[model samples]
Every structure is written in structure tokens, then in C-alpha cells.
Target: PSVKSVIQGFLPGLALKIFLIMLPKLIMAMSKMEGYTSFSSLERRSASKYYLFVLVNVFLGSIVTGTAFQQLEQLINQPSSE
Candidate 1:
């Protein structure tokens, strides 16, 4: 396998792992910056932010990417004479 292909395969998973590890801390920091003085409030805001991130990134992103790939495939496979 070529180095480019290997890096392409590995980099996304590695980046995703790093992002997942950092996301909670990042959200917590942002929440603190937003000035939630109580622990419960901070946790609540952080959890909501995390949930929104997951919903949009994972669910909506999957749907959008899947549809885009399907369209690209169809376009590529379609005959020019049509």
C-alpha cells in the first residue's frame, strides 16, 4: 500500500479519536467561559452542547454525506448520451 493511502486511512480515525477526547473538556471550558457559576448549571449546559454536537455531526452529517455520495455515484455511472 502507498504511504498516501495509508495516511488517508489512518488520519481520519486518529483525528476523530483526538477530537472525541478533547470535546468534553472543550465544551466544559466554553461553558465556564459562559459564566455558569454552579456545578449543576455548568454540567447541564455542557451536556446540552455535547448532545447538539453529536446530533448534528453524527446524525445529520451522516445523512448529508450519504446522500452526496449517492448523487456522485449516480452522476458518474450515468451515460452522457442520456
Candidate 2:
């Protein structure tokens, strides 16, 4: 395959990887802002945030194309049965 084609594949997966890593840390930071009284609260907050991210990805992945956003247009026009 051409370099351009390889790069196109690499970039999205790279962005998703970055997002996955950053998301939990972002939640961790935000949780501390509220001065969480217990470790359990912080842990629960992080898990909930991560779960939301995974839920969105799993739902959208069903309509996968070269990239997630590209499939959204197709899904929008698709009939419910699909």
C-alpha cells in the first residue's frame, strides 16, 4: 500500500489511543476538584467516565468504516432495520 494509505490508517488509531489514555486522567483530575472524601468516590468517578467512553465507541463501531466519523453519515441515512 502507498505511504498515504498507511498513514491514513495510523492516524485515527493513534488519535483514539491518545483519547483513551487522556480521558481517565482527565476524570481523575476533575474528581479531585470536588475534594472527594474517599478513594471509592474517585475510583467510581473514573470508572464511570471510562465506561461512558467505551459505550460510545462500541455503539458507533457497529457502523465502522475507515474512520468512525465517516460512518456516521451513512448511519444517519440508514433504515432502522439495519
Candidate 3:
């Protein structure tokens, strides 16, 4: 099997999971840093920061997922040549 398609397919799923996990943490961190406590305050902070988090997560997750797929391909497919 060609490693290229596997890498592409694996990356999007990994990136999505990474985005889901990272987004809330990113929002909470930014909210706390800005001293937001109440629901409204946090909502406002999260509203703005969440978009930034999405952007950041997309970039970072793509990089990470791509790297992970590359490593996976190598580990799975690299033959023990004579």
C-alpha cells in the first residue's frame, strides 16, 4: 500500500481529535489569564479566544498528525532490507 493516502486519512482524524481535546483547555487557560470567572465573563473570553484556538489547533494538529502519520508509515512499512 502507498503510504501517502494513509498519511492523509490519518492526519484529519488525528487533527480533529486533537482539536476537540485542546480547544477547551486553550479557552480555559486564556480565560484564567484574563481573570474571567463568571459565566458571562468566561463566555465572552471564550468566544473570542476560541476562534484563535481553532486556528492554532488546526495548524498545530495538522503538523502533529502529519508527523505522527509519517512515523507510523515508517514503523509499519519500512522493510528490514538485507
Candidate 4:
């Protein structure tokens, strides 16, 4: 109940989640305009952008009353038996 109550308090996170999902595609579109000389370079740029997105979303997000770390904690707490 306590966790559920905390999760239910924030609503805008849904929109942020949606934007993050689409971020990679957005990076690809911009990469096309940049005209990279090699396919690997384009892929690398897109990957860098995606990682930056996650880094900001995880590290900076924790500064707020967000669930990023909570989910991380849940993942870390799982048994290694799996």
C-alpha cells in the first residue's frame, strides 16, 4: 500500500516515459540529416544519445521523488537463484 500510494502521486512521469521511448527514433532522424560517412558512425551516435537519455533519466531523476531508484532497488534485491 505504501509503495502504491507513492507511485500514484506522480502523473507527468507517464509523458516523460513516452518521450524517452521515442527518443532513439528521434535521434535517428537527426542523424540522417547529419549525413554520417559510415553506418557504424550513425549507429554509434544514436547509441550515445540513447545512453545519455538513460543516464539523465536515472541519475538526475533520483534527485526528485521518483521511482527510478526504487525500481533499481527492487532489481538489486532479487535473489540470484534465478
Candidate 5:
């Protein structure tokens, strides 16, 4: 490859790396500007509720998935008549 093409290819990737590296710091700075460091009691409650919501969702989802798989297995393993 020519030098220009090589640099052209590398420039975007290097820029992307630099942008990604700086992104978290930028976000943290913005959060600080917004007074985002403090947590409240309500936030803890909301987090706990979110965890419970996820658990309930997973529980129901697994039950449905298991039933579907059981039905699929029964259909797939049915004996073939000659």
C-alpha cells in the first residue's frame, strides 16, 4: 500500500481510539456538571426494584422457554410410520 493510503487507513482508526478513550472522561465531566455524584434513598429503591423486575422477567421467560422446548422435542422425536 502507498504511504497516503496507509495513513488514511490508520488515521480513522487512531481517531476512533482516541475518541473512545476520551468518551468516558467526557461523560464523567458532564455528569459532574449536572451534580450527578450523589445518590439518594429513592435511587436505591429504584435500583432494588429494577433488580426484582429483572428477576421476575427471567423467571417467567425461563418457564415459557422450557415449555416451548419441551413441545419442540416431543414433535421432533415422534416415531416415523413406514
Candidate 6:
């Protein structure tokens, strides 16, 4: 593959990894900004936010990727005369 394709393939995974690594800190910052009085409350809010983020990210990512792959398969298998 060409360099452009190689970079394109690698960048998404790299970016995702970086985002996941930073997600906890990001959540904690937001929790602090929300003005939770106790550490426990802040922790709880951060945990919930992190959980929701992960759940939605995975759920939507899977659906979109699956649909894209299905469409790609159809395109590849279709007759060229259309």
C-alpha cells in the first residue's frame, strides 16, 4: 500500500488509543467543574460519565462500522454493468 493509505489506516487506531487514555482525566476535569463537594461524589460522577461514554462509543461505532462493511461487501460483489 502507498504511504497515504498506510497513514490513514494507522491514524484512526492511534487517535482512538490516545483518546481512551485521556478519557478518564477529561471526565474527572468535567466532574470537578461541576462542583462536586465531596471526593466520593466527584468520583461517582466521573465514573458514570466514563461508563456512558464507553457504552455509547462502542455501541455506535459497532453499528456504523458494521453497516459500512456490509455496504463495502455489496459494492465489491456487485456486477460492474450498473
State which candidate, 3 or 6, has the greater TM-score.
Answer: 6
In candidate 2, what are the lDDT values of residues 1-82, reduced to their tens digit?
9999988989878888888888888888888897986889999988997898687775556556447766676788884693
lDDT tens digits, residues 9-43, model 5?
89977975676566545555554565656655445
* TM-score for candidate 3: 0.46
**TM-score of candidate 4 against the unseen true structure:** 0.53
lDDT per residue as tens, model 3, 1-82 = 5799988889879978887777777787778887877988787778777777667767887799899999999988996678
Candidates in order have lDDT scores of 0.91, 0.80, 0.80, 0.80, 0.65, 0.88
Clashes of 6: 0
Winner by TM-score: 1
Whose TM-score is higher: candidate 4's or candidate 6's?
A: 6
Candidate 5, lDDT over the whole model: 0.65
Q: Per-residue lDDT tens digits of candidate 6, residues 1-82?
A: 8999989999888998899889989999888898887989988999999889888897787899999999999889994785
Model 4: lDDT equals: 0.80
Q: Which stretches in model 5 have alpha-carbon errors above 4 Å?
A: 39-82
lDDT digits (tens) for residues 1-82 of candidate 4: 5877767765567767888889888998888889976878988999998899788866676766466677778889984575
Model 4 steric clash pairs = none
lDDT tens digits, residue span 1-82, model 1 = 9999989999988997799788988999999999898999998999899989989997899899999999999889994784
Error of 5 at 77 (Å): 53
User: Which is the winner by lDDT between candidate 3 and candidate 5?
Assistant: 3
Ten contiguous residues with the weakest lDDT in model 5: 41-50
Q: Is candidate 5 or candidate 6 better by TM-score?
A: 6
Rank ordering of all candidates by TM-score, starting from the highest? 1, 6, 2, 4, 3, 5
Q: Cα RMSD to native, each candidate? A: 1.6, 6.1, 7.7, 10.0, 12.7, 3.1
